[model samples]
Target: NAGVTQTPKFHILKIGQSMTLQCTQDMNHNYMYWYRQDPGMGLKLIYYSVGAGITDKGEVPNGYNVSRSTTEDFPLRLELAAPSQTSVYFCASSYSGGGYGYTFGSGTRLTVV
Candidate 1:
């Protein structure tokens, strides 16, 4: 089974272009999160969802949007992509509010120039 899947493992975007990074988890976890890691930096939460139809903005939600319509899917949308948005995105999921540990996707590397 695919624990978690993220599409477009790598992408290059010209400034002002937009794209959606897709994430899906096979494990029926109640919590899902989007995190971005800058070069030589730790990951920062961009957004999260506790359940379907419930979403919350995390530490760095600016210039990005997210929607959780089902337990298995949470997609992140980049708006007016900018150089500042260049980073590697990771998607993770866990059950029981993360007490069971998380299953993370391979990650998507994005470059905005």
Candidate 2:
């Protein structure tokens, strides 16, 4: 499988601007997730979807939104971005078990100025 891929590896947005971090996978995973990794900190879940039409908010869902319309795509939308939203975003996909451990994307580094 091709695993997961994210676009705009790096980005710098103004305080009120917005952006969409694209994500896709070829593994036919049933679960997709969005997470943010702060410097020297652990990953915090932003949003997740168990399957198509089953999206939900995660630990740090503020200033962010997501949708999983298909098995391959789960894009994260940042609206009215703030400085606190500046962080490394990652997209992951898994086949619905702990054993799979999820496949992570290269990551999208965003800086909300």
Candidate 3:
């Protein structure tokens, strides 16, 4: 579907390396979020933005960064890759932060060695 697209479906990173997980949505949702899911664990929110140029940290924002430059793009950046950061990253968007449903990207599987 053209709802949300995440690039680089799989990646392997060395310690101290960095990468950006690209996320884009065609639905023009105003609320975007970056989340990571570890094995046997629930999804942890990393970052979120309500609109363009506005962002806030979520539950787990230690090793990640996010920017919402426009309504369609919200990229999550890993400054220094760590083994603990290895997880499946997901991007989701919603029309609003209330009870509205969200459209989620496939996911980006990252492994930091």
Clashing pairs in 2: none
32 in model 2: Cα distance from truth in Å? 0.4
Candidate 3 clash figure, as a count: 0
- Itemize residue pairs with steric clashes in candidate 1: none
lDDT for each residue of candidate 2 in 28-111, tens digit (9 for 90 to 100): 899999999997889999999999989988898988888888989999999999999989999999899457798899999999
Better of 1 and 2 by TM-score: 1
Error of 3 at 88 (Å): 0.2
lDDT of the structure predicted as candidate 2 = 0.92
Which stretches of model 2 miss by more than 4 angstroms?
none
Query: Which candidate gets the maximum TM-score versus the true structure?
Result: 3
Query: What's the lDDT of the predicted structure labeled candidate 3?
Result: 0.94
- Residue 75 in model 3: shift from native, Å? 0.3
Q: What is every candidate's alpha-carbon RMSD to the true fold?
A: 0.9, 1.1, 0.9
- Per-residue lDDT, model 2, residue 41, is 85
**Candidate ranking (TM-score, best to worst):** 3, 1, 2
